[model samples]
Each structure stands twice: as C-alpha cells, then as structure tokens.
Target: MLLFVIDLLGRTGPFSETLPAGIQAVVAGSAQKAADFHVNPPPAAQCASCHAEHFQDWSRSSHARSLTSEGFLRTFPQYLDFVGIRAREDPQVSMACFNCHAPLLKNADSEIIRRVAAFVVAKDINKLDGFEVGCVACHAEGNGVFSGPIRNPKGNLFHASKFSASYKEASFCATCHTWAPASIPCSDVYSDWKKSRAAKQGTTCQACHMAERVGITAVGLPQRKIRSHIVPGGRSADLLQKAVALHLKAAFRQEHLEVTATVRNLTPHRVPDG
Candidate 1:
C-alpha cells in the first residue's frame, strides 16, 4: 500500500498560504502556472548544510523515497492501470501520479513534470531524486520564505520564515492523505480522523506521528522542543502494538456458540486507513 504512505505535497492546498495562489493548481495537476511564475528553493542536500539533524532524519524517512522507492516503481504502473490510464500508452497522461510522488515539481514548470514522467517510464532513477519530496518540498514557501509551527516563527532571525498554525494541524496532512472522491473512502485518513474521538480531544496527526522532542533546530541554532520528522506508520511494528489492540470473546448459549471480536484503534485516525 504505497498509497498507504501520507503524501502532503500532492495537494499543496495546506501550504498555499505561503506559496503563490496558482501553486494549488500546479501541484494538484489541475492546471499550470503562467510562465512569469517562478520559485526555486534549496534541495535537501543544500538544506543539510544548515539543518544537519533535520536532514539526517529526513534522508532516512519514507518521505525522502516517495518517488524513488522500488516498491513505488512497481506499484505506480499497476495503479495507473487500475485507474484506467497506461503509462506506456501516455506517460504525460499518467503524470498526475507525480502530484503525490514528486510534489516538489510545484516549483518547476509543467514541462519539467512532463520530462520527469518520461523518466519514470524509462525507469530512470538518476533524474528523479531532485524532484522527490524533500526539505524544500515541505519547509520552503513562496520564494525563499519558510514556515513551521514555531511560535513567532523566528525564521527571519537567520533567514526568512512565516508563522504557520497549520504545521500543528491534522488538516495539513489531509491535503494529500486524502485523494479519493467523497463517495469513495480510499486513502481518506482525514475523514476518518474527523469523526474519531481524537479530533474531539484536539489530538492531531502530528501529535502522534511528529511527537515532539528536545533537539537542535540547526547546526548552530539553539536546542528547543521540535517535532520529529521521523514519521512512523501502521507498518512500524512497535507503533502497531502501541496504536492498536484486539479483543476476542466466545460464548455458548442454548447449545449454540457465538464469537465476538473487537478491535480498539488507539490513534485518532483509522487503522489500515487506505
């Protein structure tokens, strides 16, 4: 279930507050921005020069391999066929998958996305990583500005930054965690969380996935409470036991046997969500 992974970049709606107004259409594959529109953020490797720790965490994350993973390579074609499109038949037509897998294309022109799609059809990995979901894909906003949940968002102290309350909200993840139509509940974790008890308690997705820890913000930045980027999921064995539970009961009444099984999902969102 590669679709099992949460893809926040595909639907830049959550980050649109900091990006250009047309970025929403660009990332969603709904339309392209005008030629005058432009954006260029540093790559994960460049960001690593300053945010070594954050980069280390992200480099090992599934988010980093959202586009380059072997499983994705195999699954993507099947996914296209399942949806009635064939990459071999029309690579550009199936390019919509890039919306989720290679969201950083939001900064590049649609022509760049088309080229990446051709590379994907050729199974060319060398040219793909640059477009993968990386540091800039999430952190960088319109132009050089960045945004996060930090109070006062003192990014300008070193560079440029913007205060983003959304960084602390579940809706941010839902922008891509959600893909299916209203009638269908495919990869609809956001809707499941909405009706869950956790939403009522105000417990967000980040509360669990991005549990905060005291760590360095940058190479020389002061140590502070920062949300971890090492996002775990249902596939993580330890997390599985912690977030899910099962109960079984069997009863016999009037020479008949009855069995009852109950599952308790401790997380606010649904388990096996996708």
Candidate 2:
C-alpha cells in the first residue's frame, strides 16, 4: 500500500493516456479532490513571523492587492460573467486569468474553490480577503518547499530552503508577465524586455523591481545585503521619471506662434506598458 501511494505521487508522466475513459475520469476526480482538500499549506503570516521587514515591504506592494485592488475587483467578475455566457458555446474556454490573480487556486481545495467561484459569480467584492496573490505563491514550490536566490542560507527553521537561480533571472517573471490568450497579446512586457537592449546586456526584472538592500534575511542570521521585496514597476514614481525625457521649445515662425514638444524614451521598452 505504501508503494502504491508512492507510485500515485510519482505518476507525473501522462498516466491518463493509458487508462480507460471511466478510469481516467475517476483518477482525475480523485486528484482534484486531493488538491482541493489535502493541500492545506500555511498562510503568508507564517513567513512574516520570520521575515518581518520583507513582509511589510510586500504588504505595501501592488502585488499584495492584486486580487483586492479596486480596478481588479471591478473587472474580474465581469470577465467571469463573459466566460459564463460563452462557456456553453465552447465548454473548454480558458480561465487563465486566475493564473496570476488567484495563484492559490491552482492547488486550492474544493471548498476554497467553491467559495471563490461563488464570490466571483455574485460580484461580492467585500468577502474576498485571503484570495489575493500572497508570499507563498511565488516563493513556495508545489511540494511546500520555500526557495529564494540565497545560496547556503542559514537559521531557517520553518521549512526546507534552497537556492533557485530562476529567482534572480527574468524568465521567472515571464511566467505571468508574458501571456497571449486566443492569439491576442494580453501582456507583452517580458517579450518587450527580451527584444530590448536590457536583455542583451543581461539586465533582469529583479534588477529593477527587487532592488538590492543590506539587511538580515531572517532572524538570528547575520546582516547580509539581499534583494528587497518592495518590488515596484511602472507605477513607481522614480522609475517613471527615469524612463522618459521630455522637452518643450517655443518660437515664432513667420509671425505665427509655433511650439514643439519632444519626448524621448530612455528605457529599452515602450513606456506605460500594460
């Protein structure tokens, strides 16, 4: 029985392809049930207990409010309504929006899924508190392991720790920042960066968002400089000021007033990116 459980856990290579249709359904249903209930991982507060500064930084970031932001709260349910209307025509309509907004739902238990679905369907913006993108969404692996860019980290007693080069690279941000749905470019930030001189020069997303800082990563650990969690983007005033240059010239040509304004993009990619 132990070996059977191990085999089930290790079955990641398309086992459904070899199973009968009824058996496949049963297996899929069982897997979904397990995902919905058995995956009760800890909340973001657990991480805050050890990394208070990082937690505080993240709390003020837009990422912390990805799901609860007024703009997102207004449009998300309308999107769900559109999906519901079109779902009958194409039952396989993609629901990829949740990939970034509600990352937890990727492995949420059935009860959580039902509650979120109900809130979205009813447009109940008030009750959706814990559904936003949280710390574990980006740092934790599927098996409940926490990872970061720190190599040989110490003083961690909460969970297993490991160094992931991807955390320091641009491709990590590309997972969600670059996506095309139904051949329509929803977000092309990652691709834009790739085509820009920044990518050629080895500039990464973390270089701008998660800027370096000198501080302790955890309690009881020596103070070492590390990438900060106060990740910022286009909305950052300092970044916007540095990304573009504007100049205005006024003159009189042939007794007629002529004014010219010049705007130059200092950044590699287009400004005001979506």
lDDT (0 to 1) per candidate: 0.63, 0.64
Q: Give the TM-score of candidate 2.
A: 0.72
Off by over 4 Å in 1: 1-41, 79-92, 153-158, 181-186, 246-262
Model 1 TM-score, all chains together: 0.71
lDDT of 2 by residue, 1-274 (tens): 0111111222333342544344344345444434443223333444565677787888888777776777776666565567686542331232365667777677655456656655655667545544566777788765536788888867332357778988888999887788756533356788888998888999888887788888878756678897777777777898788788988899999999998999988676778774
Local lDDT at 213 for model 1: 86
lDDT of 1 by residue, 146-230 (tens): 7877767544222477778888888888867777665332366788889989899999888878868888876566889877787
Worst 10 residues of 1 by lDDT: 1-10
TM per candidate comes to 0.71, 0.72
lDDT leader: 2
Q: What is the lDDT of residue 5 in candidate 1?
A: 14
The number of residue pairs in model 1 that clash at the backbone is 0
Assess candidate 2 and give its lDDT: 0.64
- Give the lDDT of residue 24 in candidate 1: 31
